[model samples]
Target: MNALGLVVEYNPFHNGHFYHLAESKKETNADVVIAVMSGNFLQRGEPALISKWERTKMALHCGIDLVIELPYAFATQKANTFANGAVSILEALKCQSLCFGSELGEISSFLGANEFLHKSKQQYDELIKKQIKTGVSYPTALTNAFQELTNGKEILDLSLPNNILGFHYVKSIREQQAQMKPFTIQRTSAGYHEQNFVSPTIASATSIRKSIFSNEGDITNYVPSVTFQILNEYKMEKGLLHNWEQYFHLLKYSIMTMTEEDLLTIYEVEEGLENRIKKNILHAQSFQDFMERIKTKRYTWTRLQRLCTHILTKTTKQQMSFINDSQTAPYIRLLGMSSKGQEYLRSIKKQIELPIISKLATFRHPLLELDIKATNTYNMIFEEPLRSKLLKAEYATPPIRL
Candidate 1:
C-alpha cells in the first residue's frame, strides 16, 4: 500500500528513467513503483514517439510495477494541470509517496517556493496580470511574478523545467490535502531540452527523439536494449518514431476548415485566437511555421499547440471544463501491472473511491473517450499491415498482466 508514485511521459523509456525509478524506490524504501504516465499524447503538445501500451510495457520490463494512465485531458495541458492530474491519480491510488526528478535536486527550496507562492498568491496574481498585459508569455510572466514576490530570488531560474513541475506537484498535493509524501531525485543527465547526450548511458529524450527523426542510428546507447529492440520493431511495423511535425496537414486542415465559432468551442481557444489562426493558416507552410506565425507574447507556443491538438482531436471546452470543475480524475484505468501490482490492486479495490476500469465496455466517460480518440488519432498515422494490426479498440486491449 505504501507505493512510490512517479509522474512520467517516458516518451521513450530510457536508461535515465530507469535510474530515476530505481533511485526513487531506494530513497523512499518503497515496496512498489506506480507511474501515472501520459498516454499517446504528452504534456509538451507533441504526439508520443510510440504507443502508450508500448511505453507501459517498457516501464514494466524495467522496474515500474504498475502503470496507470494520466488521461489525455490532463496529460496534454499546462504544467500545473498536468501536476494536479498526476498527483490526484497517485493520491487516489493510495500512494504513500511521490517521487520525481528535479533540477534543483533538493526538497527544501521547492517546499520554500511553494510556501512563498501560497502566501503571496494575491501579489503574484497582480504581477502576473500586469506582465501579461505588457505582452509577456504566461510562463515568463509567472517567473516574473515569483521573482517580484521572492524579491529577485533566482529560485525560478534554478528550478528550470522539471523542478517547476515538482513545485506544482507539491502545490497540488497541498491543494488536495493528500497524504502522499514527496521526494526528489536529482536529474542525472541531459536537461529537458538539452540537445546533447550527457553520457553514453544517459541522454535527453529530446536528443534520442532527434536521433530517431534524423535516422542517426546512435540512440541505442542512451536507451536500454529492450527499448532499442521495441523501438526497432515499432519502426518497421508502425513507422513509430515521430514528432508534432508529422501532423502538419492534419492540424492545418483542421484549423483552416473550422469556423470561428467552431474554434471558440474547442478547449483553450479564446480571445479571437480563432481569427488569428484562420488568418495565418493559408500562408503558413508547415506546423512549425504555422505555430510561429500565430505565437505571441500573450500565447506561448506550447499553449497554442495544445489548443491546436484540442481542435484536431475535438476535445471541447465544455468537456474539459466539466472534468476540471469536478476536481477529480474520472476513473482509474490500469495500463499494465506486474503480479505484485495486481496483488496491490486487489488489496485496495474496496477502499479507492473512483471506478477501477478494467474494460472500456463496462464503463463510459467523456474523459476516457477523449483518451481513446487521442490514441486512435495516433493510430491513424501508421501505414500498411501495422496500421491495421495496430488499430486498437478501447474495449479490446485489456491491461497487460505480467
Candidate 2:
C-alpha cells in the first residue's frame, strides 16, 4: 500500500483539518494516511483542549486512516525539532510522500527557497548572529537573514509559522536523505490565528479552539458533526476539557519546588532562566503572568511556554541530548487507527525498525517515562473521579481501533 504521512496535532480535528486530510489524499493518491500527532501537550506549550484519545477518535471518525503519538519530547519543541521527529517517523514507515498545509503552496517556489536556504546556511548563520546582537528576536533575525541572502526573493519568510515549519519539513527530508516527497496544500480562507470564520467550510484551528474555549458560537459550522458531539460528550461526562492555564498550580509547584541545579537539568531552562523562573514563580499570578515576566526579546512567549512545559514535565537536557546524539526515536507509539490502518500496520509490522507499542503493559523506557509523566502532569487539572481516571487511562487504554 502507498502510505501517506502527516505531522498533525488535531487538537480538535476541525473542518480545516478535515479539508487538509481530504486534500492530502487527493494530492498524494495514497492508499492510507498515517498521522503522527501530538499528545496532551502541544508545540505552543499548552495542554490540548481535549485528550489524545478523543482527538484520535475525532481524526479516525473523520477521514484519517491511522494516528500515532508524537512523543512529548518532540511534540513540544520548536518547528524544526517537531518536524524532525515527525518526518523521521514518516520516513521510517516508508511513506511515499508527506502532505501538509502551508501558506506558500507553490511546490517549485518552496523548493527553490529550500535550496537557497540550504546553500546559504553559513551566511544565514552569520547574519543571524549579527542581527541577534542587534537585539532583534531570533525569528526576526532569521527573516532578516533570509531577505538579505535571497535579495528580496520570497524564500524562508520565517514570519509565517506554517512556512517556517514547512521549510523544516523539507530540510529534515534532505538532511535524512529520506525518499518521501513533500506535497503542500495552500491554506484557504482564515489566517492561522484569525478567529472569525472566513468560510463555513474553511476556518482556522485557532478560531475553532477559541469558540470551544468560550463555549460560544456554533462550532458545528467549523468542525465535523462527530467532532462536536465528541467534544460535548467529553465536556459533560468527564469534565476534562481544558486550556493551558488550568494547570498553573502544577507548573508553579514544579518550578517552586525545584532547586537551581534541578532546574538547570531540565531542557530549555538555560542561562539563569532557572533564576528568572524561581524569582517569578513566587509572585506571578498565572501562567500568562509568569511567562510574561520571564519572556524577553531573545526568548519569545512560545519559547518560554515550551520551557515552562519542560519544567512541568521534567524533561531533562540529558534526556534530550541522548535522543539527539542517537538520532533515532525510541519507539513508534500508536494512538488510534481505522480498519484500513490496522491492515496496513499488520502488513508492515515485521519491517518496522522500532518497537510498536499499542499499550503500556510491560513498557519501560526513559522516553515512554517522559510521556507518562507528561500525561500525569496534564491530568493534575481534573478533580476527583476525572483526575484518577485520566491518569489510569494512559496506562490502561488501548489504541482506538475502529
lDDT of each: 0.85, 0.85
Q: Per-residue alpha-carbon lDDT of model 1 for 162-249, expressed as tens digits?
A: 8779888989999999999888999886888888776868888988888888777598789888898888887786655767878888
Residue-level lDDT for 82 in candidate 2 = 87
Task: Judge candidate 2 against the unseen true structure and give its global Cα lDDT, from 0 to 1.
Answer: 0.85
> Which residue segments of model 2 deviate by more than 4 Å?
none
Model 2, range 14-64, lDDT digits (tens) per residue?
Answer: 877888889889988999999999998999888898889999999898978
Clashing pairs in 1: none
Clashes of 1: 0
lDDT of 2 at 300: 84
Candidate 1: where are CA atoms >4 Å away?
154-159, 384-389
- Name the Cα RMSD for model 1: 1.7
